[model samples]
Target: MENRPQPFHITLVRHGESVGNAEARWQGQADYPLTDTGRAQARALAERWKNENAKFDLLISSPLIRTKETSEIIAATLNVTVEFDPLWLERDNGDFSGLTAHEVRQNFTHPQFSTPYDPVGGDGEGDWELFLRAGQALQSLLKREPARYLIVSHGGLLNQFMHAVIGVAPQANNSGTRFRFGNTAFAQLMYYPHQHRWAIDRINDHAHWKDTD
Candidate 1:
């Protein structure tokens, strides 16, 4: 009998544009439905995954409505079911919730504001803490299943996870894959169990929407 090779393919996808996202407001822990364009983006992602023909053993998403919806769309195309988890939700921005990026920078610039390494506003979970939790969660999921998986989450959350898994900080611009994932864009990562490391395979792969523009 031949031993099967370890399955370690993981795809991370940011949810489509929500109302707060389109409005340029902070959407941390805010539940918003996908906009019309967001729905289209979800469909586009589904079609792209279908064309790729890669089989995913599991589909996981943040409990947030936007991510859940997006994951559902992709899962439908893949003919799979999705598992929802709150741990995958975006960081809680605390008082900065529902504020625009400019607003967050201009008025809320506490010493700990933008630095994930510090306590978030001395109230919410620090960015580093979220990163650690995400890493742990991903590891646990993979250990339990050890198969190809898809994770649909928010941009901020996904970015943090990417930084954690790739050993890159936010300021390390050119050192790692900087993913500006548009609505429904997908990124791939491979987890090598031997090295216990996750490697970025692709970033912001939006081939499905290329011809639409």
Candidate 2:
């Protein structure tokens, strides 16, 4: 019998709530520690995985404080060490970093018309740039041997990664599709490198803490 190519099992997770999240800040690349609720969410996720007997061969995370804290909690529960990568970092929001919605409106003037190529926050990454970065991150992951990978990252990057997986280009002026990744929410995916095929098993999974804040 011919040997079948091993499929890569990837779980993309958004970090739990942070101080910035509580403050409703943009938080793009701005380091903010997880809030108390955020830590509770992480624990809940860890408990859920432990109960499910979930196993991951590799654990990767963004170095941001929020993501690092969330990943550390899960890693402790799963007995996996986390490898941090800047590529997994959140999209740089430039001038908008650590700003709230009202503050952003007060500070930056909104362009009447903008394209995906237009820089965000007057200097931050454009949609296409983030998409390209996501593609690069995906490619790097594929270079490793097929295994179960748990990635703790930000919502913006994860959304771009999903777009890359589905071959969707960035839309102009934020009119593109969006994936909602709540605190401690995750997306499970499978990739067959030999056949260049991908499967999305789940998206925005946070059943463990649906009842709680």
User: Clash pairs of candidate 2?
Assistant: none
Counting clashing residue pairs in each candidate, in order, gives: 0, 0
Error of 1 at 180 (Å): 2.7
Best by TM-score: 2
Give the C-alpha lDDT of model 1. Answer: 0.77
RMSD of each: 3.3, 1.1
Q: Locate the minimum summed-lDDT window of 10 residues in model 2.
A: 204-213
Tens digits of per-residue lDDT for model 1, 105-169: 88865552255456554466576677777777666676675678888988777887877776765
What TM-score would candidate 1 get against the native? 0.84
Error of 1 at 89 (Å): 0.6
